[model samples]
Target chain A: MKYRRSGRLVDMTNYFLSHPHQQIPLTYFSEAYKSAKSSISEDLAIIKEVFEVRNVGTLETAAGASGGVTFIPRVDIYATGNLIDQLCERLEDPERLLPGGYIYMMDVIGDPLLTQDLGRIFASRFRSAKVDAVMTMATKGIPLAYAVAAHLNVPVSIVRHEHRITEGSIVSINYVSGSKKRIQTMSLARRSLKPNSNVLIIDDFMKAGGTIRGMMDLVQEFQSNVAGVGVLTESIHEEEKLVNEYVSLTKLTEMNVKSREIKVERGNLFDDVYQI
Target chain B: MKYRRSGRLVDMTNYFLSHPHQQIPLTYFSEAYKSAKSSISEDLAIIKEVFEVRNVGTLETAAGASGGVTFIPRVDIYATGNLIDQLCERLEDPERLLPGGYIYMMDVIGDPLLTQDLGRIFASRFRSAKVDAVMTMATKGIPLAYAVAAHLNVPVSIVRHEHRITEGSIVSINYVSGSKKRIQTMSLARRSLKPNSNVLIIDDFMKAGGTIRGMMDLVQEFQSNVAGVGVLTESIHEEEKLVNEYVSLTKLTEMNVKSREIKVERGNLFDDVYQI
Candidate 1:
């Protein structure tokens, strides 16, 4: 391997950070640098030191027939914002129209790469927010919660629609979903959450903030404080109470599935990033 | 920022490969290295080159105040198996005991970091194996599927119960669950899966391999091939067909919740890693 006269650790860390938590074969790296294994191992030691000293990133090495190093979430503000902006642009695309003024952003949510990135970005943001535990309802919310919890190294409590045979006992909360007149119940286990938890709420979609508000009530029942709120897509409507501050990948205003017309708005997270 | 000696691009790529998909704040890296922003920028450029050339990893940077950097899953084989070894150890813990022979690995299965690692590790193992999509049953399997799908960069399709609520229309398959005398049906959308799709089967638990076999039959109905099968936990049975190669985090031979005693046979993935 040609050792460049100038070998920069910061550049290396930045590259590692940007490519956070990606797994590649050792042979791949070996082939790329054409460097002896010993030299590469030494460089990783330095990189690991850099990450540990800062306490903002991690470098893990796994050796064997199926082993290689992998990075974990420890990104700073600059990188987090840049990713949110890219997401907003995708959300802003006019082609995202669906029925009932709802934008069909399933493509974005369904894309594991995008979801993984957004999950890591938000996880970093929430990490500094001092949340006790991250919470999300079933299905879609699981991935987002998983992402955040992974970054923060916290447990994710998933709320199910009707208690499953899995969760022995549950604490249920009944409330109106959005503006709907019907009452719906959402539940968590007493064993799962502690009293007075500092919780960060995350979900795939938020409209009329009812489900989110219900979650807030669920938080209150446990005497927990809503530390913050974050959503993949925030539906546009005035007067969403109980949200102190929020971050969203996309905003849906008016959707006419019949007419095939949908109005979408982007969030400030992206704009804030590009300005930097 | 300090202007110090920089590391080689291959060094950074190797470091990142072992530590795939992490997001760390820019300030953290900047302060750790005491390096100029420009130098760090140059380092990222070189790192990006190795990633592009390799086609096995991705680097995404978020700009602005709220921005940071993250690495997405792009790990190769050597790294993946090592992770599985760690996972199997965690799964083998005595604390994971549950009713019957079931191991309550749902916590790890539900966990983001563990799940992500599991996905990367498994993806690496099956990287060269042809597979169109990752498949799993509803409920618990969703998370596992997402994990594998994230690493493989493939779509995860869900198989539902006999009833059709989550899945409006489905292609059906009938099979026995473990020792159950009665046969049960598993369903997947006829349109959801592409014809002749190569499928990687994953599940939370496999008692008899019947459910997985049912999934195999479902794939056959769609004229698809079983690329491989993966289970979070596989219970030992006297008579379970074992024709195909499979992967499991833990092997459960016996358990008695009342006695609070359990037996766990660890997978061989661990020893292989340590020996190397």
Candidate 2:
């Protein structure tokens, strides 16, 4: 069957978007479309042009018998800035202030579009990092972890506080809650991570980084390495943080429970130059 | 600057894929690309043809002043069947069998690609339903819920067993665990769902449908309606199910803890005719 250029372009674009970070040989498309290799190359040229021009992502091509093209998903600096600013505005709502200075953010975390945009930002930041899996604590961080995992084309490994019978064998760790100073336990299934794999830890919110520290420790238990850390929001009011190196999208600057006042600022995502 | 047909096609395809279920006016593309409406119409014709032939989605055109095109994502029957068969094969592994006949499904649920496929299947099934939000219990059900919510362009509302101060005002419900006959508590934030909203419930697995029943009751507590229910796997060995109406992808027919044997089959997803 002979496929037209228009059809191939549409199909190829969809293929690249869905299979981000995957390298596809030109011969694969050539055989599937029953077209010449030259024709497939021209089609990829058009796709690469559009992807770059629109800031959709980057298409890196390799020239060799064992080479192909890879689609690296990225969110451009302008889009990332706009998204973070919007998140800051949303987080500044006084109604989100709880009684104990805790900000209610389930709605923010639950917004699929928002989380997807945030995920793309994180994916762009860590596009060059080797991530075998995206890890997060259960309950709240699952969505953000899955969001980043989807963009990076990796599986998500969830850490849970309470052990479940269906998890088979688990590796449990006890850590101090950074702010409350209360001891908490976090566990991961034994089969969740492979040894020596590079895992990216993600969460919705962080204060003193206790949960993220616990996750980092859990990753070490699996003999895995922490490739990078990304958080949706982090509290700057904490006297000290347990974990130091991480990327956060938004920062909680202030929260007054008595006055029901809350303040938010853009996180340190763009403090350093990043290349995709 | 005027854009070429190739660029317009690539941009339009990406837009439709990203903004599923959203109606885009022909003039919107025409204006963005600096092309005539006739040219934009031709582009849409090509996109619609490719989308249908590829089973990517359906592009419905409305003929009126408010007329435009809406992209409804779909997976063809062959692809759906192949995915389900793969899932069944994966589930039949004896190593997944845990104590008390429970199958360890963290890997399956943690799989981003698998959950996205299952989410697409559920989204296709519930394409025509009026789903205001996708609801599910936290921990296991979150990934599936986010997957469906992303495809449906809706937000997700997570239900949790324990309440946190970060959730603000919450509504709690007590229900009997269908298999264990023990009362359990589930809570949802008051802001999660609006009154009279239609919520689509999704989960990873179901034995007696107790968790789903609890979710349904929780939805009622907020004065909302259950738009639909979807489960990745359901246990057919159960004597009775608490919920009757649900679409399941795979069925666990038998399990033997002593023998470490398990049996799985395709669920009733294809038993009924569906229209995209």
In candidate 2, what are the lDDT values of residues B1-276, reduced to their tens digit?
Answer: 578998889989999998988888988988889999999889889998888888788898998999998898888888889889988999999999988658989888888877888898889999999789999988898998898998999999999899878888999999888878899999999998889989999998888989999999999998999999999899864477999899999999989878878899998897874642
Locate the minimum summed-lDDT window of 10 residues in model 1 chain B.
B267-276
For candidate 2, write residues A55-86 as lDDT tens digits. Answer: 88889998899899999888788877887898
Give per-residue CA lDDT, model 1, range A1-276, as digits (tens): 444323333334545654555655656655656666676667677777656544356777887988888766555555555666566666655566533445545455555656766776676555456677788887667667766666565667777667655554568988787645478989886656778788888898887777788888898988889887788877766665445467776676665556655555565445465221
- Which lDDT values do the candidates have, in the order given? 0.65, 0.88
Best by DockQ: 2
Q: Please list the residue runs of candidate 2 whose C-alpha ends up more than 4 Å from where it truly belongs after superposition.
A: none
RMSD in Å for candidate 1, one decimal? 10.2
